[model samples]
Target chain A: MSDLTLTPNIDGADDYYAELLAMHDGLSREESDALNARLVLVLSNHIGNRTVLSQALAAAALKPIK
Target chain B: MNQIFETPMYAYSRHADQDATTPPRHKVIVVGAGPVGLAAAIDLAQQGIEVVVIDDNDRVSTGSRAICFAKRPLEILDRLGCSAPMIDKGVLWNTGKVFFDKRQVYDFNLQEEGGHAFPAFINLQQYYLEKFLVDRVRELQAEGAPIDIRGRNKVSAVGTHPNHVTIEIDTPEGSYNLEADWLIACDGANSPLRAMLGKDFVGRVFEDNFLIADVVMEADFPSERWFWFDPPFNKGQSALLHKQPDGVWRIDLQLGWDIDKDHEKKPENVIPRLKAMLGDDVEFELEWVSIYTFQCRRMEQFRHNRVIFAGDAAHQVSPFGARGANSGLQDTDNLCWKLKLVINGDAPESLLDSYNTERVWGADENIQNSSRSTDFITPKSGMSRVLRDAVLDLSEKFEFARPLVNSGRLSVPCTYDGSPLNSADALDGPDRSRPGSACPDAPLTEGFLLPKLAGKFTLLTIDADAPDVIEEDGITVTRLALSLKNDPTLALKNRYLGEATSGVYLIRPDQHVAARRPSFDDKLFRAAIRRATGKE
Candidate 1:
């Protein structure tokens, strides 16, 4: 049952990761990698995106990427 | 006693202070009756002035704690007429959705880019908005109006002299001394008279703690706004429910920074993590449970000598983006029309130092946009939680990553830019720049909007034969004819008026446009009403 139809074009970062899997009915990949590094700096400071936020900060390797 | 001072505005100011031994002076007092000091004592007793107020609490604070009001604080509670009975006992909400984990990313409707007249939020229950503002300051003290409220009086001291502001009080008939001619302080956020004026509140504190509860539910859950990212029973928690008006529900969780704040008042460690994230035949009961702990602070000054400070005693944020009591009721609707134009000398006292430099630059930009929405919903490491879960897993297959997975940039509105009541047409062009922001609510007819020309001091022409520019010191225009099928973003009427010159605008009695001539020149509409009532 996942064609993802909570609809209304869900995108505030996938409706906050489907409201964090309906408030954690499931999640554990170390709590979805600690809420995806705070949702890639909160959706890269809100939608300025920076190339999928530098590929999610080089797949979460995170450093001073000046 | 004696029917509570037999109302005729406190029995004609206590029979015009029969042989006064003190207790009469008040061109403004107002300490804290809440709802931004009873909306600055009902907009300075509906502009006739006087106003007293006080309160150290004898009533009104059942703690529902600001239950969302917005639509610009219901057009500043429809200019003190009490927003149609707090919008007929509140609960409007125009869609908000956002859940990433259970998959459903963004949904904001707010009646999609529409006009405005109240609908874009309204929950009502900050103790019934302070009992509908203490029943409109007891119907302006039974329609006589000098306004005085007392309530177990408290202010235990506050000197400031230069032409009045003595204060002292302690009541239960034991101590007293009150003089006024100015003193505001909507005493909150521990503002004991802004700590008896040694001011300097500065910022940032967050280590995150949240918890809140307020339940009742028999779950069918539909009133939108749920939010739960990564909530496996408190593994780095984050949950939020909402919907409240009777069958109640206001949840919120977040807990991080390693628990133990009195083991979060165990109800068996919070009812099995709210019955494991609300399921298992959802029942519900909790009704009230708190824990909160945020601090984004502000007050470097919201006026000092003569006293003034509104809401959370001038700034404190981190309810994420509820923008702390709607920016403390827009700092009591921008310091009640600049303290009713400097106690009615119609401006000067340096327009009350531009209400502490535009509400301390709107409380340091709403505490840095609610601390960048609490660091994008709690990301304190683990590579910022794997870059916030790879942007919620590439916002589930991008569309230019859906407005960065729907953040709407901490709901816009924060613009003052070096204030001193900003001018050069509120700092030059782009159709009257955003001098201390808030205005933007367009779309006119068809179920009337354009902020129902919000509470007064409006102009907004858009050429319905634009002429009558008023302001010989009465400033309350409302024209609004606007066309092009009411507004297609009109991109600010085609970049500051030229799609055949129309929109005049102006606004500000805290509805905020404060200059947008584009065309209808009458010395740029009386210099945008003397630079929005600070009489340039």
Candidate 2:
């Protein structure tokens, strides 16, 4: 019963995905993981709605039916 | 060698005081003839006060020490009649680019809106700055200004008194003693004057060293500040490149905390680093090489009885933001006007306390900003570095994260908010020119607004009627009226009288807004002048 926009929310989706990968290019394994964690925190702070965040977390954790 | 540093400009010369039977008393004695001390001496002399400047050394600073001069200090220098040569010889630029790991993250333009006289910033060698100031001092002296700069004369001991201060000087002949009604210490961070008085600064010492190399024969680089974070040339560190006058380029490389001081400063060792960064094809000669480790610190109080402290003698900050000499100039600019009023007896001695209050506030602002820039540049902890890198990474693609990059937030004018000198603010105008703020310069029909407000208390009115001059308790306040008809561009209205149809501003001698109102009020303006001069 959550009203969260989950379909095509980002423009230039491929570019953002490529940049997300490029961000960890020269960093070590631990540094890349730290960066990902920090990026998650930064984005979470940007999107401060707890209800939407909770829904996004649930959706990200769910698996596709095989 | 650069002739400015090599040739002694003010060599040791015996003054009449040295040969006198009784030690001659001076109105004001400024210790240290560096840029700050020279500026203090110049300001005090220009105000008809007899001032003497003493220094251990005889020449301007070497190695092109402080290169970046910000707008506010430039404005102050303009008032002192020394900005013409500085602007003529300085490399003016407002654009700065920040690069992260070989790719540019973002670029910024400090594009101050048009109509101001000076640019946002200029890069001129410190030697040139000091030399120009010395030249001005000479010009003032030629015009019979009561100013004397005694070189190779050092102050070894200082005795503070209730009404005056006794200074013991050291020269080749012998030690001599003199007294002064007031003493100003601009003797730099390692101020011997501060030590003689058992005073000290209390702040943080940053654990980082930056290698500065002033190289001649620079390549075709744009006249802009280019800063790099964790570039390949120096992995896990930062670098800065700036264009200076005379085809010289200043390059700073971050060498971590625990490095050999002497070994790293060698030309043989430094050239390798430079070659690595410059790709070995470029031809450049190292004009000067220096390693500097900075601290963000300041004294508990600038005023100590009859002796006062200004510039590095009072406070210091890391060199990241070019705040050292810049803020030192501002310190004198804030102090000299108040000191002049106090010395002239137009205002009470309590007026000098406003100098301590306002400049201490200014020093704290510089220290805080430079400290933050130091932290951002050299992250202490692993998590901090991670967070810094994350911000830089995000800044590459995200416009919102660009503001997070702090490669030295350049120095700006400090607004003395909540100052005791400030009267109530009632003008419905822009906050940038509010009470206790530096007056933002705008173009007048003739020349500029700042030149008109030079070295006096002014009542500025825009479309508002006010008297030509007002005298309150022996202090004089003159009027500078401007109308909307003359301001065709509306720069004045936009900067000072925003939204309001008319405005009146009471400006301090140091070009700071003392108070503002919607329209002219006789009693209010008179009372504000009294308060500004510390009569209240």
Q: What is the C-alpha lDDT of each candidate?
A: 0.67, 0.87
Per-residue lDDT of B43-125 in model 2, one digit per residue for the tens?
A: 98999999999999999998888899998999999888899999999998878889889898888787676888988789999
Error of 1 at A57 (Å): 29
Candidate 1: where is the Cα deviation over 4 Å?
Answer: A1-66, B1-20, B32-168, B171-174, B177-228, B231-261, B265-290, B293-318, B333-335, B345-394, B404-409, B414-471, B474-511, B514-517, B520-536
For TM-score, the strongest prediction is: 2
Please estimate how well model 2 matches the true structure, expressed as its whole-model Cα lDDT. 0.87
lDDT score, candidate 2, position B93 = 82
Candidate 2 runs further than 4 Å off: A1-66
Which 10-residue span in candidate 2 chain B carries the lowest summed lDDT? Answer: B394-403
